[model samples]
Target: MSHPTAPPPYEDHNPLYPGPPRPGGYGQPSVLPGGYPAYPTYPQPGYGHPAGYPQPVPPVHPMPMNYGHDYSEEERAGSDSFGEWDNRKVRHTFIQKVYCIISVQLLITVAIIAIFTFVEPVSEYVRNNVAVYYVSYAVFLATYLILACCQGPRRRFPWNIILLTVFTLALGFMTGTISSMYETKAVIIAMIITAVVAIAVTIFCFQTKVDFTSCTGLFCVLGIVLMVTGIVTSIVLLFRYIYWLHMVYAALGAICFTLFLAYDTQVVLGNRKHTISPEDYITGALQIYTDIVYIFTFVLQLVGNRD
Candidate 1:
């Protein structure tokens, strides 16, 4: 028997829902009224995707990492502190060396002065031999020029020490001869005054914020003025030795050299606009020694009673 004829393919023939039939079948895609393709087909793995469909996202790549070594906080701090400590140590050592040399030089000079001032024979010999004083002065000038102008000789190992020794001896002899001309009591008083003034000036230079190094030009001008005054005074003295005029010259000299001592001390300290290099310990010692000695000489002249 003919099985009940298969129900005709179901169709919604309702009048209210009218449209063109699906091209493929009930379960397949169909074109729209605008003649465009039905829902876009998925692209193959290697092919371009149809527009408007969510595109297959490109495979994501992670960012590259930094592999360089980084310093830890402790290591960085240690390195910084080490550098500062090393610098301070070097500066301290330089200062110590300079001061030690100066101390030795001063001791030698003081001993010479004492022998010349207190000892009868030495004092007479130094005084009678005026040529020796001139010779010592010449030696002092030559050695000073070599040390100040020739870096090679100044920095040479044993040679620098030798030159400095010779220079110190020459200067000491000259200073002692000058001391011989002064009364013992006056020399002692002048020595005390020089010591006091030198110590005071050094303390002030280290403590004060005022930078004397910045006044290099002023120092030069003052130096020139002092030199001119000294020349005029020398000429006046040759014509007639006026006690007041000589005293005035000595006073001016003492003041000028006192300022120089302060300047040189600050330079050696290396905390100012003008600082001696750490490598130039010899130069630093030389400058400071000269300033101090000059201070003593000028003070002696200012206050000492001539024998």
Candidate 2:
């Protein structure tokens, strides 16, 4: 069979047939071979049906959806930068406030100890009233424990600040009484050492990438070990005379609590992924205070000149 030749293009100026009514409109492009439209139909009638054949749409570049609001360039840039700046400022303020609370608590605790250590009448009274000291210590510790473990909206607002202040004061009283039993020189030295170590650990937690928060399980185990060791050491000191044993116990306790200080600092900093919230400043201060107390206690034991 002979091959059929292609038909000539439909001309709009043809005198014979007037070119099929100008392919659906005047000034519109002619439909090309195989029913493809030749020109863009943007801003024209029959937009989707140009020249009776579907016009190849210029690929409508839809505006990126902005959660339904049409934000201008400056508005979008300002919003993004403002959001980042606000987050950074919030974190900075939170850290500063938390540290300020911690510093105040530390000062209160240290002042209590200094009062008891330096004041002759207060030291004598605490030394003489053994029963009262024990009672007050037990009461303060129980109060702190209950308040610390309790979690609710009460732990949120003004209640948290009030409770934490009370806890700090009570703990300071207990610590002052206990420190009074130690030699003044030992107490002062221990305080200095504890302060230095705390400062160093706080700096390390802030600067280092080591995520001490991940060792929660390890800390719990160490806490249990310390408790058992404390019980055994207390019993030994109570029933038997062992100076070296006391020293060893004190040294071990100091080591454990220093680690705890580092861990708690990391949690308080809230920089790591497993960090405590900035809102938990009360808890953070409590943790750091407890670590410092234990550190001081152990250091005092190691340095105290026992009669």
TM-score of every candidate relative to the true structure: 0.72, 0.71
Give the Cα error of residue 23 in candidate 1, in Å.
47
Instruction: Put down candidate 1 lDDT per residue, 1-307, tens digits, no spaces.
Output: 3432222244643333354543222322333444444443333232234332353354333433545756678867765434333477787898899999999999999999999999999998887889989999999999999999999999989989999999999999999999999999988888899889988998998799988889999888879988999999999999999999988888888888888888888887765677777778999899888888888888888888887
lDDT of each: 0.80, 0.75
Taking all chains together, the TM-score of candidate 2 against the true structure is 0.71
Off by more than 4 A, model 2: 1-86
Q: Per-residue lDDT tens digits of candidate 2, residues 1-307? A: 5522322255533353254433333334444445554565323344335444554555333456556878788878866334433376676776787778878988899899999989999889888888767776777787677657877632668777777777788878888988888888888888899889888988888789988778889989999998999899899889997989889889989999999999988776665545655556677777888888889888888888742
Best by TM-score: 1
User: Which pairs clash inside model 2?
Assistant: none
Error of 2 at 150 (Å): 1.5
